[model samples]
Target chain A: MPSITVKNLSISFPLYHENTRSLRKMTHLFISGRLRQDQHKKILVQSLRDINFTLRQGDKVGLIGQNGAGKTTLLRTMTGIYEPVVGHIRVEGSISTLLDPNAGMNFGLTGRENIYLKCSINGYSKKQTQEIAESVADFSELGAYLDLPVRTYSSGMQLRLGFGLATAIAPQILMMDEWFLTGDAGFIQKATKRIENMVQNSQILVISTHSAETIAKWCNRVLWLDQGFLKMDGTPEEVLPIYLNKPYEEIVKKD
Target chain B: MSDHDPTIVKEPVIDLRSVSLSQNVKLALTDLFQGLIQWRLGWKLALLDIKLRYRGSILGPFWITIIMGAKISTIGILYAYLLHLDLQHYFTYVAISVVLWTYVNGMVNDSCLIFTSSSQLILSQRLPYSIYVWRNVFCNILILLHNLLVIIVVFTIFRIVPYTLYFLLPAAILWLVNSLALGIIFGILGTRFKDIPPIVAGVMQSLFFITPIIWKVSSLHFNSNYVLLNPLYPLFEIVRSPILGENVSASIWIAAIGYSLFLWIAALFIFSKTRFRIPYWM
Candidate 1:
C-alpha cells in the first residue's frame, strides 16, 4: 500500500555569489552610493520543472539524465528536503535515501556507536537501533573492528559499514543516487548483490544511474530528464533506446 | 517533520502551500515536540558530540568546568574586591551566573552552525530538522550539567547550602523555551545568511560584558535602569536568583516570560516559512 504522488513539481536554488554572500560588502555598497536598489539581484537556478509521477508498491523506476538534468534534485525533492514550488508531493510511507553512503556515519565514533547514531538520525528509536545493531555488525563483516572508530577503517571498510546501515534501515521507499557505489572488484560485487536484493525487495525504488545496461536489466520504468523537463517516461524497454539514441544534448545541439 | 503512518489512511499525506500563520504554528509545534519526544536521539547525539570533543582526554566534559573554574575564580577574586563584596558570596554569585551564561552563550553560538554542520545528515535523510537543533541544545545542557558540578563544589566549600535547588527544574524549562526559540531563529537565519554565525559571535562577545554575569546587578548603582531592558538580564536572573535563595523578581520573570513568548511566535513564523529552504541554503 506504499505510494508517492508528485504533482507538477519544480525546484530551484538561489545562487549566491562572492559579493552577495558578504553582508558587510553589501552594506558598504549601500552606504557608499555604489549600490542601487535594483543592483541587488538574486540569481536562481531551476533544477527541476513540472515533474509529475506516481510510485506505488512494486515500482522500480530508473531516473536517467545528464549532469544537470535534475535527477538528484528529484530524489531529494521526494525526501522533503527541498520544498517544491507550485507542486504537491504526498508520500505514503517512510523513506530511506542513499544520497551519500558516508553522510550520517560519524568518523570519530566507533562503528557500533555510529550504527546507533546513524540509525537514530534515520528515525529509529534507541531500542530499534539496538535490535538491528547485531545484524548491522554481522552484515558489515567488520566484526570486532566495529568497536573501533570509523576513522580507523579503510575506505572500503567504511563503505561496507555505510552500505550495511543503509540497507538495514529497511524503509518502505529506497532512493539511491548512483544505483551502486563501486569500490574494488570484490567489495563492489558483494555490495552489488546486497543492494540488488534490497532494492528488489523494497516497496518502491527510484534510482538515478548512468548505466543503461543496468537500467535495462533492473528498471520496470524509466524517466529521462532533459535539462529540467521530463522528456520521456515509459518502460525502460520503450525509453532506453530513444534516450540512448538522442542523449538530450545532441538533440539540443541539432535544435 | 511529522511522520504519518505508512498505511494510506488519507488521500494527501502532505499539503503544499505558502506557509500560513496557523499552519506555521502547527508545523513549529509538531517539529518541536517531535524532537522533544525523541529526546533519546538528541541525548545520544549530545553524548557523542561531547565524547568526540574530548576524545583521548582524561577530563572529557570536565573541560567545561576547568575552563569555567579558571575564568570564574580569576574574575571572582578581582571583581569581589572591586565591587566591595564578600569573597564567598561574590564567588557563589559569579559561579552560578557563569554556568547559566555559558549555557545561553554556548547554545546561541552553537545553534547557528547546527544546520550547516549537519548538512550531510539533513540531505541524505529526512527526519525532523528540529532534531538537530535539539541535539545542539541538549549538548549545551549536558555541558551545563557538567559545569553544575562546579557550582556544587563551590557551594560546599562556602558552606552555603542551596535553598531552592529544586526550583532549578522549572527555571531550566524556562531557559530551554527561550534557548529553543532563539536557536530556531538563528539556525534558520544562519542557514540563509553566511555572515550570521561569526556576526553572532561578535555580538555575543559584546553582550557578555553588558549582561551582568561577572558583575553583580545590585552592585551596579549607575546604568542599572538601562541594564533592566537587557532581555538576557532576566534570563540570567530566573536561574541564578533561585539558587542564591532570593525571591524571583516579578519584573525579571515577566520580562523573561514575555521575551520568550514573543521569540517563540517570531521563531515559529521564520522557522515554518524557511524550514524547507534550510537544506538548499546549507
Candidate 2:
C-alpha cells in the first residue's frame, strides 16, 4: 500500500551568500524601507521546477539525470528532508533513505555504540536494538573492531559498518543513491544481495543512478530529468534508448 | 524476518506548502511536543556529549568541577581582600553566585550553537528541531551537576547549612524553562544569521560584568530597586538568595516568572515563523 504522490512540486534554494546572510544588511534594508527592492535581487537556484509524478506499489523507478539535474533533490524532497516551495508531496509509508551511508554515524563512538545510536534514533525498542546489534555484528565481521571507536577503523571497515547498519532495517519504501554500490568484489556481492532482499520486501523502491545497466537490471519504470524538469516517465524500454542514445536491447543484453 | 504490516492505519502524510503563519504555528507546536515526548533520546545524547568530551581524560567530567573551583577560589579570595569583606561570608556568597552565574551564562552563550553544531544530524534526520534544543539544555544541566561538588565543598568549609534547599527544585525548574526558551530563540537566529554566535558571545560578556556575580548588589549606593529592571537580576536573586537561606520577595518571583513568560512568547513567535527555514538556512 506504499505510494508517493507529487503535485506541481517546485523547489528553489535561496542562495545565502555573505551579503544576504548578514543581519546588518538585513536590518539596514528594513530601516531604509528597501527590503522589497532587495528581495528582488536575492538569488534562488530553482533545483526542481514543476515536477509531477506518482509512484505506487511494485514500482521500481530509476531516476536518470546528469549532475545538478534535481534527482537527488527529488529523492530528498520525498524523504521530507527539504520542504517544497510551490506544491505538496504525499507519502504513504515509512521511508528509509541511503543517500549517504555515513549520514548519522558518529566517528567518536564505537561501532557497536553507533549501531545502538542509530537504532535509538529510529525509535527501535530495546529488544529490536539487541537484534539489530547482533545482526550487524554478524554481517559486518568486525569482531573486536566493533568495540573500538569508528575513527580507529580503516575506511573499508567503516564502510562495512555503515552499510550493515543502514540495511539492517528494511522500510516500506527504500531510496538510495548510486555511490553505495562501490566497494571490493566480495563486499559488493554481499551488499547487492542485501539490497535485493530489501527491494523485494519493500512496497516501492526508488534509486537515482547514472548507469543504464542498473536501470535495465532493476527498474520497471524510468524517470529522466533534465535541467530540473521531468523530461520523460515510462518503462525503460521506451525511454532508455533515447536517454542513453543507444538501443534498449543492447543495454539489457550487455547487462 | 523483514515483514512489515502492509495495513498502516493513520499513515504519516507530509502536506507541504508555501510559508503561511497559521500552518507554521501548527507545525512548530507539533515539533515541540514531539521533542518533549522524546526526552529519552535527548537525555541519552546529552550524556554521550559529556562522556565523549572527556573520553580520554582521567578525571572525565570532574574537569568541569576543577575549572569552576579554580575560578571561584581565585575570584573569591582576591575580591574579599580588595573589598575588606569578611572572608567566610564573602567566599560563601561568591561561591553560590558564581555557580548560579555559570549555569545562566553557559546556557545563554551555548544556546546559539545548539542548531549550528548539530547541522549534520539536522539535515540527515527529520526529527523534531526542538530535540536539539533539549539536548543542549540537558548537556548544560549535566555540567552544572558536576559543578555542584564545588558548591558542596564551599558550604561545608564555611559551616553553612542550606536549610531552604527544597526551594532549589522550583528554582532549577524555572532555570530549565528559561534555558529552553533561550535555546529556541538563539538556536534559530544563530542558524539563520551567521553573525549571531559572535554577537551573542559579546552581549553575554558585558552582561556577566553587569550582573551581580563576582560583586555584591548590596555594595551599590543607588536605589537597589533599579537592578530588578535587569531581567537577569530577578532570575539570579531567586536562585542565589534561596541558597543563602535568605527570604526572596514575592516581587522577585513575579518578575522572574514574568520575564520567562515573555521570553517563551518571543521564542514561540520566532520559532513558528522560521522553524521550517532552518534546514535551508544551514
Candidate number of the best lDDT: 2
Candidate 1 lDDT by residue in tens digits, B1-282: 225654534432444544566776687678788888887787788888998999999987788888888888888899889878899989999998888888888999998888999888888766677888888988998888889888888988899987787868877788888778888989888888888999999999999899988887777778676776888988788888877898876887788888788888888888877776788886
Clashes of each: 0, 0
Give the CA lDDT, 0 to 100, for residue A174 in model 1: 79
- Positional deviation of residue B131's Cα in model 1 after best superposition, in angstroms: 0.9
Instruction: Give the per-residue lDDT digits (tens) of candidate 1, residues A8-97.
Output: 887766666544467785565346443332234764556777888888888989999988788998888887777665688878666778
As for candidate 2, its clashing pairs are: none
**TM-score attained by model 2:** 0.94
Each prediction's TM-score against the native? 0.89, 0.94
lDDT of 2 by residue, A1-255 (tens): 789999899877766673646788557535643233225787566678898999999999999998878898898888887877688888888888888778778899999989988898889988889999998999899999999999999988998999998888888888999877888999999989988888888889999999888787789999998878899999999999998888888888887
Tell me the spans in candidate 2 whose CA falls farther than 4 Å from its real position. A18-41, B1-5, B8-10
After superposition, the stretches of candidate 1 with alpha carbons farther than 4 Å from their true spots are A18-41, A125-131, A246-255, B1-21
